[model samples]
Target: MAGKSQAGGERIEHPFDPLFNEYSRVLILGSFPSVRSREQNFYYGHPRNRFWKVMATILNCPQPQTVEAKRALILEHHLALWDSVAECEISGSSDSSIRGVRPNDLSIILKKCDIRRIYCNGRKSYDIYRRYIEERTGREAVLLPSTSPANARCGTEELINRWSVITKDLQSQK
Candidate 1:
């Protein structure tokens, strides 16, 4: 949504809009975009990220290979996606390197969508939300194990199991 800056080798702004709609029933938050995501201008663009795979497995849908397909999969299933840090100085895509955080305004999506549940993609996102957005939104986000490749300790099947919680929300919407 804004220009990217590499000053001090830290990203200064979020590069894309949050994905959501009036009918969206669930909101998923990541801490921030990875370098690959920024380059592709989409969420979880890294090939090794297990987000797409875990989503497909839990939703019982085909893995989305294109940005358009990814959007379709999320929107069609009443899920919304966005990041917690709107502006941050970080070294590459390392969440631990993030600092000077300016959290996103979730009301932009919350006002438009009937989101019933909020899910954080990892501990970083959960921590950020709890620290910055939770008081403002008055909603607690469920922490899900990260699907990032860096989280090798949690395999895809385990991620699928943990992420399966969202399906109940989605199914209830139907």
Candidate 2:
């Protein structure tokens, strides 16, 4: 279905595209895009999500309001963003109901870049990667608390604190 319309009559071909750089030092995997996120075409673009805010605070970068700025942040910090699932015909955003976890084509990035570490944004993502991708690739990944607004159990400060531990390498490399 090329350029199919959503229930709200908004035209969309697919969710946001995966992003990575040639010299990426780390990869952050999300489970799947929410409907709002799919419409916006960016990761954690939802205002309430606070992922960019947390990352900006942790990395000492300005809050990214636009997709270009977010891409710039990833490029500037050598961070990559993509989901564990490639393209699943799922009904909604709930990861528990996710099926057919067809792994994403990482060859383009893997061939061109040096990926030092893989970080899953949430437990659902990590679980999917463990079952689908990591088993095949033999690549171990570190799991971080989910930054989605849905994961209110882990507050922004806690999320950033956990993320800081993993991203210490990024600071060292700079």
Best lDDT goes to which candidate? 1
lDDT for 58 in candidate 2 is: 82
Which pairs of residues collide in model 1? 1-15
TM-score of each: 0.95, 0.86
How well is each residue in 1-174 modelled by candidate 2, as lDDT tens digits? 223234323222336677887878788888877676877878876688777888888888789888889889888889888888766545556666556556776665667788878889999889988887886666898999988877979988888899886569787766
lDDT tens digits, residue span 102-137, model 1: 999999999997888999999999999999999999
Q: Which ten residues in a row have the lowest lDDT in candidate 2?
A: 1-10
Question: Which pairs clash (backbone N, Cα, C closer than 3 Å) in model 2?
Answer: none
